[model samples]
Target: MSDPIETAIFEKLAKADPKSVGGKSIEPSDVAKELQPEQWQRMLPKVKAVALGLMRQGKLTITKKGKAVDPNSFKGVIRLRLPTEAETAAALAALPPVVEDDDDFA
Candidate 1:
């Protein structure tokens, strides 16, 4: 089964803009705080993990000091955002269409 907390993290990322008012990338803490005000600190680790997962899946990007970083290896502050439209289109093109198999019960 999928983790609901992880799902919530992804949903928050999906709704976040890639750039902020001053053109800064959105930090993982931003989402965490938005999801759980005073409890954001406890939520940080999980949020970062989910962001890394999304980065690996090409659904999001992670950066540090304005440069992209390896999500699995990065150990410091990082930012997360939905992929650009072009990246999103390319990722969609790379995926095979889902086809439900009706033979599961047979």
Candidate 2:
């Protein structure tokens, strides 16, 4: 159910190569630029928003100075990465079940 931008952010972060960035993390700008080469500059804010939301959900980790920061107070530069298996599992467990709507107009 992710929108294009959210999908793009995760795709970019998931495919990040550790050797290239010293770790499996990438800058928000990287995702923005890949989604819109020419107008990439405008995508930075959206990228951060998705990243922060994911971090709040525990599916992602946002870091500053190689340590996890409080999403509510983070500022300046940041890096995004997928959480470890255990962390992801915990996050998944915490999420409410998705209930599909089944309205009928008979």
Candidate 3:
């Protein structure tokens, strides 16, 4: 089963209209906004788990450049490439369609 926090992030990313690659790394605000206080509390561990999983899979990498990249600093920002149209279409196609009365889930 998909972790709910990761699912929340995915859903946020899926709906986002990313306008720029620079500035702040896509703030977690959008996803955070979707969750209630209780939901966010429950989601923290799952978010960490998903991040660790991505790190283990080598999808997320930490670059080192002593001093230039301090772990404590938040300035070392990198942009994430949003999927291409074809990729987005393929992703959307991979999902099962929403049933007529399934708006709540979809």
Instruction: Give the least accurate 10-residue stretch of model 3, judged by summed lDDT.
Output: 62-71
- List, residue by residue over 1-106, the lDDT tens digit for candidate 3: 9766566655554455345221123334334446656566465445545533433333322222311121134343222223444434544564567777646754
lDDT of 1 by residue, 11-83 (tens): 6655654342223357778778877899999988888887776666667667788766765478887876556
What is the C-alpha lDDT profile of model 2 across 53-93, one tens digit per residue?
Answer: 88778778788888777777989999987777665666667
Q: What is the lDDT of candidate 2?
A: 0.79
Q: Please report, in order, the local distance difference test score of every candidate based on alpha carbons.
A: 0.68, 0.79, 0.41
- Candidate 1: clashing pairs of residues: none
By TM-score: ranked, best first:
2, 1, 3
TM-score of every candidate: 0.60, 0.71, 0.36
Off by over 4 Å in 3: 17-25, 38-49, 58-106
Supply every candidate's count of residue pairs whose N, Cα or C atoms clash at under 3 angstroms. Answer: 0, 0, 0
Cα lDDT for residue 76, candidate 1: 82
Which candidate tops TM-score?
2
